[model samples]
Target chain A: MIFTRSTLMVLLLTVTFGVSFALLSPIFTDAQLEQKTFVTHSGRVIETSGEVLDPVYTVSTVDFDPDEFLRNFEYGRISISDNGQTIRDYTIIAEDDKVQEISPGVFFNVWTFNGTVPGPTIRATEGDLVRIHFINNGSKSHTMHFHGIHPAEMDGVFEIVGGNGGQFTYEFEAGPVGVHPYHCHVMPLEEHIVHGLYGVFIVDPKEGRPPADELVMVLNGFDTDFDTENNFYAANTIPFYYQHHPIQINTDQLIRIYVVNMVEFDPINNFHLHGNLYQYYPTGTDLVPSFYTDMITLSQTERGIMEFQYDYPGKYLFHAHKVEFSEKGWVGLFLVKDNSTSEAYYGN
Target chain B: METSEKTSRIKVVTSGIIPFVFVVLMVAYIFGPGADLLDLGVPLPELTIEKIAFEKSEIHVTVRNTGPLPVQVVMADVNDRIHPAAIEPDKFLNRYETALVRIPFEWNEAEPYTIGLTTDDGTRFERNIDAAAPALQMNFEFVVFFAIIGTYVGIIPVMIGLLWLPFIKKISKSKYHFFLALTVGLLLFLGIDSIEEAFDVSLENLGGSFNDVLLIATTVVLSFLGLYYVSEKLTGRADSLRISKPVVIGLMIAIGIGLHNFGEGLAIGAAVGLGSIAFSTFLIVGFALHNTTEGLAIAAPMSRGKLMIGKLITMGIIAGAPAIFGAWVGGFAFSPFSSVVFLSIGAGAIFQVIVIILKWIREEGDKNLSSAAVAAGFATGMFVMYATSILI
Candidate 1:
């Protein structure tokens, strides 16, 4: 009877101790983990036990959304021409007096096409008649020069559209089956391009390559201090925009990114995808894939098409391979979601 | 008596003849070729761009004409391309006139833009923005930031110094006079410092538009007379209530110190806004230390009075809150002319308070200002201010 009583007491005590230990362990562990110390760039020391996160996003002073810009393809007002040809009519307005906050507390005056840094992404299929009603509503002369096979007079160069409501019409046949950059071809080309007077022009093959979630990534930079050196870099116009609002994609879904490089005052810029390889189409000129890679280096106005698929559902990073550019607001993230869990996930 | 009257009449006649002869000579000179020589051809239009602001799709260029002749801007250009512009208050600018030229140009950020104004004579006056940046706008966040800065440098430090009131109250009667002398000494130093600062700002920032020396002198005299009149009125009303004379003097000291602190806040806020001074831990601490002595000066005279916590707090606020207004003005819309005027007013207020304190000290049985304690306190007060200033 004494042995049984002793055993019972030990069991009760042990169970009590275990339960108490289990309850108290999480509290201590959480307290340790929650206590965080952060040092700001301005050398302010902050200590917190609760959530100590810098705001995930700052309300941008400029109204350019990178996620919306990614998949926003302007097919223009399509119409059937008298010759039964597909005509894509676009009105490209060039303006020179728009101030944009490229980075936090750093603003830049960005000369724009259609009031945006990269302007609008104009898309056309091969053999289509591309007619652009160009308007210079800015304070400087500008012209839309597309990089493709077109007539001499149809070239944006040599035909300088005057400022203050100057108008011109550019008609051409979309011959080249690839992604091209259309920009202001006025003199002092670098000045026009650097101020964001450039955008993407994708001419799809008549047969069409493949259907995928299409996106546009225009890599650019801003010389905020006007020291002839870029102070900020980003995929779209605003810096660190994509990092704050990550692009969502479904797992195992094919992703097509039409990437263009429009950064001036720099020799080169590059893009690298984390945890995934992509089939790279140099300029998207050919139907077949040229290279399978996770990274690609581009020169000024250099561009390509990237097609990839994620096998696992998780967060991934896509940023400039150039460490300087990436550190200075050129980084972004992709949140790949499991398709089986949510069929209604929208890709950005 | 007849001879003296005749001499006074002759003196008055002689003074009148001098002005009549001067006027005759000036009229002759004006009629002669000398007046024609004064017309030195059409002087060049000297337009200075006071500010460049980018708003929406327009560039607002604030330009001031500092030339002797009037200028008419007929055309405006952006990057050598002529663009239509609307000049407010007329494009015809007379000497010392300012106009806002609004050009509807979609300028890009981080781009170098040269805004050129073509005068009627085809003479182009150009202002180049090295890089276009957004104009600083007043917002709630900016106001809060400046308030926090003012509280750090003004209110908190002054309150901390007021903590010395209990110790001040315990001092002997002989030393009480010494503390009053110290307050006088502190005000005197602050007055001279404010004058010097006002002169410095006028010299460096006012340009040639203002005669800075004249401006400072006139402002100082006006402010001094105004405060003196106000103090006399306050004293008359206080006498009816039978309030202690020292309490009135203490209130005046608070006002004086408050004015000086407002000027100090302006300098700090302007520096921070211009990005010339880094807002660091050391700067805030330094300003706090420098301003603590101002509170001590306010408390020194009040030691003899019945010190109520509410009165002390009111005095503290009176001596400190102006810094917040000053910071707001300096950070948002700093004008050098206003800064100079405010600083001179501060100097004048300080001088007015000094006179009141000295009179109070004399009435307190220290007939002559020759006491050893007074001499030592004055020297110590000046020394404390100088030492604390080194930290800033």
Candidate 2:
């Protein structure tokens, strides 16, 4: 009887300690997400001399990579499907391509998705059905695997691969809205990824995001020497393309950038915008902005949407915070011209 | 007769109606104006430890808010010999979402540290972490390879020897008793060793925190009690068919030793993952020698003439296979919580086996040896195990 009582006492003490510890512990809730306001500006006035002042650009139909047309592609306002079902159908081809001058005079061979490093950004509203038809035109077998909730049978893998010159269809419901990445999950995955068989998949919120001049930027890199290491990195596979041809935006307009880190070899990359603070939406899944910061860090395949309005007209530079990555090729400039003047000049 | 009937009716009505009335009143008090009177409007925040990692030099915790409301994290503090300053991650974990809190403290891997977190909702969470091998430090390929090799290395010789156990049955009964006693001594040493290792997690500061000490103690006591209860419930009933007590005891020892060996495998695997090749090799050698004796221990009780070869082989597998599995797991992720839990349970199980063997010896009435000889044999067993352990 004494032993049983003692055992009960011990058990009681243990239970009390556990419950009290849970209630009184401090480490569980030490951090908080606080809101902070950054500096803001009005609009800007710019005087131009026969220069293009629009962030918009026409898709080059005859380019080596046709998916370059998707850069400024508009994914309009989000809404429920009229038929109460949102079905997004897509087809991608995996093939080898020897491209010329990723950067000036830097020729390289790459395995491409839709003839581009980062296939194409597939966009859809929440609750939409995403159907991807994948074709493997490459000599070696390849498969498409997406990073999101999906059925096992629909997960594009080697066993279910449409082998070389074969076709396979992957279908799933667009979910609990977030930014997701799709890539070749074939063995020798790193080789295929480094060579370029990847893309971004964006699921917009059901309620839709606030209006903005949206743009898609998929950060990627190239292994010039086939050494399993990247020698050059780019925002859109076109190395230094943004620097040579800067993206133009109007001052005082909300600029939303959908950025993705598709760099294979490196573990992390970051976006640091000069002289601007933006509301960061982690994975585009959150209903409200999670963070407001000028610099956003992400690991490989971590993608998100960033929103900010350029109040003054000046060159806003954006690049990987890793100086080496920026120095190689992952840098761009946003030319924010005076909205009133550009509009009048263009007679809009 | 009427008065008695009336008394019985009153008893039944009172017995059922009083509790019903009490429950109704209590419910009304709780849900009605009692809520206003008590001012219990605020819901308590429930914080759960979703994940933890000692990555780089700092501790990273993924905390989840399982409650309906969001929680504000106030401070993250670590308590040890060198108590670190409280770090305010200053983050809010939303309902059904996770927030990663980075605690700025250099972990002393050898010492157990209690991490405490406080929230705005007046709830605190405390977790004990002893050792953490970051994922970056782990080499999965080498871990799996060494784990496989270590498993076979530790028990293959014993397994092969089990194939030749038929000849051993020809030996004398006294020899069997000596071997059994020696095996008990080895296991006793192992149980003690395991307990000591588990005790290390508390940094040997038994007085400072009662909880850690209580955890290890309770695990030992409960594990023994659980096994005893299970065995008794299964076999002690008079209606049940009789099973050989020695066979049951042998299987129990093998299982207990298997758990113990799994812990050793984890250590070896972790060593490999940490890139300490020499240490892993030494551990493999020590564990292999240790396991050979364990094989002997398993076969010690099997003096029953009808022991099948297949059963012996199965026993060998049971005693040995878990080490490889442990090594594989350790290579990928190493958590001190699992280590302590496994070791404590193993110690408990081994301790129970010791009790059983001693009970059998007492019942059999050892005419072959005096008390001094028994003591000497037990001492020799402990000494041999200790000496072999030092090699690792």
Candidate 2 chain A: worst-modelled 10 consecutive residues by lDDT? A50-59
Residue A41 local lDDT, model 2? 13
Compute the lDDT of residue B275 as modeled in candidate 2: 51
Chain A TM-score relative to the true structure, per candidate: 0.83, 0.75
- Identify the candidate with maximal TM-score: 1
Candidate 1 at B262: error in angstroms?
A: 2.1
RMSD (Cα, Å) for all candidates, in order, is 22.8, 25.4
Please give the interface root mean square deviation for model 1, in Å: 28.2
Give me candidate 1's TM-score against the actual structure: 0.45
Candidate 1 docking classification: incorrect
How many residue-pair clashes does candidate 2 contain? 25
Q: What is the alpha-carbon interface RMSD for each candidate?
A: 28.2, 22.8
